[model samples]
Target: MKRNYMYIVLAYGLFLGWLLSFPYNGPVLKHLVLIHQVPIASFSLVYTVVPAVFLIIYLLFFQIKEEYAKNIMNWSITACIVGTVILFTLPTYYWYPVLAVMGIGSVMYIIGWSYYYTMEIPIDEKMRIMALVIIIGNSIYYVINILHDQISIGFLLAVIIVPLIGAFRATSNIAVNNKIAVELEHEPLPVKLIFVICSFLFAVNITDGLTFHAIYPSFDQLFVEYFTFYGIMPYIITLVIIFFFGTKLSIMFPVFLGTSVLGLAYLSFGLMGKNWYSYFITETFLQMGWALLDLVLWTLFGLIASIYGRPLKICGYAFLANLLAVFAGGLLAVRILNKLDNYFIISAAFAIGIIFISFLIVPWLSEAIEKDLRNKLFKTNLQNKPIEEISPLSIPLPQREILTPREREIAELLIQGFTNKQIADLLHISENTIKTHTRKIYSKLDVANKRELLQLSFSSRMSKGRSS
Candidate 1:
């Protein structure tokens, strides 16, 4: 549509505007670290606190599904403006709180912007656009910082351009009035999936946070250069790699690959100390891998939103899980970073152990969840009927007599081994609605789960045969 094209233009303009307005994070961090003598641990406040605030906002306002997108955007803009003002003034009194608020605003804006694109744009196109945005943003930011020692020029441009970017119309994809009227509890987020995602995130982020805190401040200029180059080089290269190899593969393929790179980066830092190449590897490859993993994680959460029928809720939970782990990891790093004697060796060993656990837990957890769901479904069926023997002819008897026509249709699919998700898709309804109907079908048939319903159908057919 013309609307989508307009949005694509706006997205590009927004990134350009953002970069022009706020050059690079390097200068801000440098100002805080050098001028204010702010502890590296203090910077963790932003990552830790902002998502919690957003989570609260998500719970309070977004739950109603009324003007969700607009509200999020407004909050983000306000926060960013406030953050920038405080930073520009270079206030000494309330340093942490001011920076934290700014971080909140900026991060919220980013979250809202990302959510909009994911909802509105197709995946392949979205990936390319995002890559371009990063490449351009970082290139502009670093170029400006490298060219001029004074930050005044960037600030002046930002003052002129940010408002123009703000005035552009942003499209909202969330329906103002939700038709299904499903309650929050019916969202059907699997526990095992949450565990797997949260655990993996925690492991990766903890390693990064600890190593970053350990090594970053020691070589500040090198750290900034490394990330600047990382942003320019790897962003493009990874996108190209993914464009070719990533098309046919599962998102998890990149995730696993990223995890490997991340672990290696950690190991290199642990063993190699503060060498320039180590910095390059850590900043470029490790970050590239992180970006890949991050892309998939957000995309998966978007899929979860579609699957569950509560976009805001599912996204919020995913965000909360990710941010919570990141915050905890940062805090832990702050504590142990100073305490460890041979920090590199211990950290490398820790990362390896965690990665090993990740491999064991993720797949096993997935299988365990599937097996558990099946077992729960099978409990009501005391008699074992061969699954295939439950036939079309058997459909008219017992539970079929009790179920509504639509429920019967769903029951037939269940007997045919269609998953709830598959049934939802085929029926062109939300998965939550499918689950609601499934529960109703179970209740009507005096059955606990899918296996029992099929058994009743089969048993009814056997009884009919005996009577005949």
Candidate 2:
């Protein structure tokens, strides 16, 4: 607990420094203050794009097999180092190190969340105290500016102090706040920690990128932004907002966050900034649209996760639901975005290609956001929901009759109300075996006669046909 607190403090301090640089405030801003100088955008290379790639790598590799502690830690540290170096280097990326430290805190928060919920361990007070110290220390930088005449930095520092404090406290003490979570047990800490940092990095990058851009149009990389999942991220993030809290009520969180992000993007593109309007518009649209869709889907994730007796079933349904929605949404988007960008006919092909590829990702965003929304909406309470659009009565797993594959096929046919001779004809099996198998099936199903056992089977088959 105390250890984490220390991390929080450092995160806060880092945030303070980054925030001060947001307005490009230095010792001489008073003579010539430029609000449009969003120095933070330069960090996008290190914070947003680079981390995005690393995360993809982490997920892909981590999912393949169990990642050992040594490997996970090595990669995690490597990622942090490379990210830090890039941030510390080029003028455009200098903001990296400044924000990266605080990004670490965000990662810690995720670790805390996962540990507290999934692993179910008691809070470590020591880590909490350390985090508290870091949080306070980070704020001290701001406090210094306030007392020392702004050093020309007073205003900028003040703007950052609050968020820094929150980040510190949340990141450091977060894990210590909770005492029990089983899910943490199986989770690879290194991999989870990497993504946690990523979440924060994305948050800061998105915030800084959009904020600075609003002040003044800058950068040529926006073509990539628009062509990427830029518009859809807000919706993707909506899932986390909802999931953080959990449940139906939590669903509102994504909407709230999505709305705010959209509003900010709108202000940046519509009223304040120019240059990257197309990309911003697309990103804003995806963000808001994902939120709307999340409200619908996350509720379902909650129901599916909780009510389905089988975990695999939960995954299966989730996969199918999102598959259908994404397929529908993707095909629909290709047709629409092409028409929407009709004015730019020369670049229409490029835009259309990007649109098609990006659409596939919507399923993930929609599914994720749905989970977040569900988590948030019902944070305070569990709500019964539509697990399935039509909740069909489920038959328990068929009795393990110890039948061979071919025998099971025969059984399935018989269960469909086929006569023994008909079942034999379908499977090219002899009638004598069909009869013998029927007797065996009835015996296994514990029916004194064929009538009772096959009665349930026939009823189930007929019902399935009717539903179909």
Candidate 3:
């Protein structure tokens, strides 16, 4: 894929975040509810339930046809436009059904584009792409929230239409590659691991729902008072952390830490009683924790989809888990907690309790799952076999003197299946430097590619073992 094509993928990410931040989950929902005098409970239910049902249906039954994916995507965009228009102009009675149709369109839109992404992009590239997407997408969301007062219906329509145009152009330019499918057949889906992680996400996000309600009792407060400092800054910081350290750190570390931070944030809210100073401190931590967890959840799903080569299935189920948890927590907060006294205290206790449970379980799950994925991805099963049995004398090994120490190190990493980018990151060098060394290593070893280099290395090692 062209580098420019990867940049274009950002349009889809921006669109997703923009939609969620505005018309779906954020300010627009509040705007509509307040203006049309729709009950919050009924509005929340229709918004959450309709899309969630569509996501679940897609997860269970829908499959995107690769050939017709572009058409599906274009049509889904049209549905979204029509749905938005109807939503803005129509009577309250017509809202629920239109929302349902829009929800289906959203699901189709996501699944269709995601299928192309998973098929065309390699896993490593997917990680970089997703990280960039989250960073820029959320930044755009924050900017919109900041300027919400200035935002007109025309502005909203422009946001949708601009990205839609870009997305259509990008999808047209995407080059199809089926090489990943062959690898997918060899690797088994880590079904149990995925389920457990999804369950953890569901549980954690329920606390988010509770705390979200506890922190901002009114949506107007979210817009006018809180989101400016407490919301945008911490989230931006979190995105930066994910962008820089995400690949280097284990997923469990951030998750555990995020949950702990959130627990403490809520605990502070209960103990400190929403004083300005206290609110600032707690809400900053709260946004950081929430942003961290949300980004990690999507990153985890993207990683799974990359490995499994079924983007729709993996991402759809992930979306379902996350959406349901948020919905359930939101519903619980609205219906039950609003009636209860000391709701902040109740929410804090629940969040802190989940932290304890996560602390106990996340380590074991992370270790086991990471180990399995690493072993499978790196072909570490060869370690269990005899050297002679696994290594064939298909390629001649070059003399050790032909390579410099740096070249040797680079070659070793290549044989171990590290990409140039990974090797550069590991060695604290520029990728261009790594590329230079890789070229020298390839030339010295008389190999055109990593596969040949691997064959040569294996044969050399096996020969040495026999001689010794």
Candidate 4:
């Protein structure tokens, strides 16, 4: 709650702005290939290798820092600029690899910024913010694509430029973690959940890979049509569900159910059905299912990072896992594309198995996570209580300048690193009210972040004691 919600909104808005600024090739790749006389293989090579490079670099060297989010946002903007220049100016296929590498960089920034922003928010706001960002960001993406041919090159450039300027301001205002607040032990992993999640992701990724490649060859014309008609459908439905029924249901329910639908949809698509109506039905389910899965999966990843207090480690691993799953799926799909009967049979069985397993896995994982979080809280409370003979009550107070009683109370709790939600619970106030109090405290004290406030308060107290 120490964070301003407006900042969160702005940060996310900038991310979307940066994302949509990159020219979408899905609708134009064929034209670019045929008209520009560029080899299709170059594009294929780029699409294949970019993810590999991204995963390798991330695993080898990406580390979390205080300015991690801001830095990533900057990198994304840089990459977008580079990619835009190359795509518009260069017609040669030779530059495809270079553009691909830049694209990879932009994608990594997307993931990195998402991790950084989501971890700071309270769990209560995580789902809503995640949904809102996706819905809005993707809407911009689709709208840009829909107008791709109709708009002028200069106008497109302006679209890229305007949001970016605002994004820069928003990103700069974001807080950085100059120090590591918590150290996490990586041993004693949650074996069951990890196993299930990995297996499920692998299976789903394979189906997704197969479906896309298989469908695109026969239905290339439908890409833009599908995007036009149903691009925002899933996101809208997701927003409604989250807005209307978020409190009544656990996220695990939608996650499992959506995944199950996705599996079935993939199975249908793999069977080589020629009926246009069936394709429409399959795609409709695919969009909705994927929307829910994306929302829940990324939110879960961010939550894990927050809970473990190791944002980079958790998110990096998740990204790596996704990369591997997608890569393997693509390879398998390529191998089986000629054998439609076998592909259909195998994909259908995999889908059915995943759906059944999901029922058992999702509920168990949710319960385990809740139980573990409770245990951690209990242990933390015990550790916070001083065990020495001296009581906390005997300690001298910080000699700060005049503060409202409410502000003083908030400062003390903030010093203890209690989240906004925790403070709201303790004070029986709304989290929004807590945020307002925090903003006022920071303004009065001229501090930007919690660490600064704590330092200022303690230093003043120490100076007063020395003089006395």
> Considering lDDT, where higher is better, how would the candidates rank from best to worst?
3, 4, 1, 2
Clashing pairs in 3: none
| Cα lDDT of model 2 by residue, 167-212, tens digit | 4444444333332211212212232322322332232233232323
The alpha-carbon lDDT assigned to residue 230 of candidate 4 equals: 67
* Better candidate by lDDT, 3 or 4: 3
What TM-score does each of the candidates earn? 0.67, 0.35, 0.74, 0.70
Candidate 4 structure quality by residue, lDDT tens digits, 1-468: 345455666666655744543432343344346557766545654654576677677667866563365677677666655665566567575466656766576556656665555445666667766776677666666665676566666675566555556655666676644332332323455546555665656655555555656654545464546656665576567665775665566768778878878776767766755456657767777777777777777677666555555555556556656656656666666666545655556666767776777777788778866776675665466446543421212222354446787788888777765678777767879999999999988888888999888788678779878999
RMSD of 4: 13.9
Q: What are the lDDT figures for the candidates, one per model? A: 0.57, 0.38, 0.69, 0.63
Worst ten in a row by lDDT for model 2: 115-124
Give a tens-digit lDDT track for model 1, residues 1-468: 445544643543454445333422344445445556656444556535765776767656755342355576566665655655665566555556766665555544545554455455544454444444444444444464453345564564454345435433442322222232232123465655755665666666665556556656545665665554444466446755664555466545666677677678678877778778777766665667666766566555544443334555555666566666666665666677657778677767776786677667656644654464454345323123443443432354573666787888888877766677766766778899889999998888888988888787789879988989
For model 1, where is the 10-residue window of minimal lDDT? 176-185
**What lDDT score goes with residue 295 in model 1?**
59
In candidate 4, the residue pairs with backbone N, CA or C atoms under 3 Å apart (3 or more residues apart, or in different chains) clash, namely: 66-177
At residue 70, what lDDT does model 1 achieve?
A: 53
- Top candidate on lDDT is 3
Collision count of model 1: 0
RMSD of 1: 8.7
Off-target runs (Cα >4 Å) in candidate 1 are 1-26, 32-47, 50-66, 94-100, 107-118, 122-186, 218-232, 243-245, 364-451, 454-468
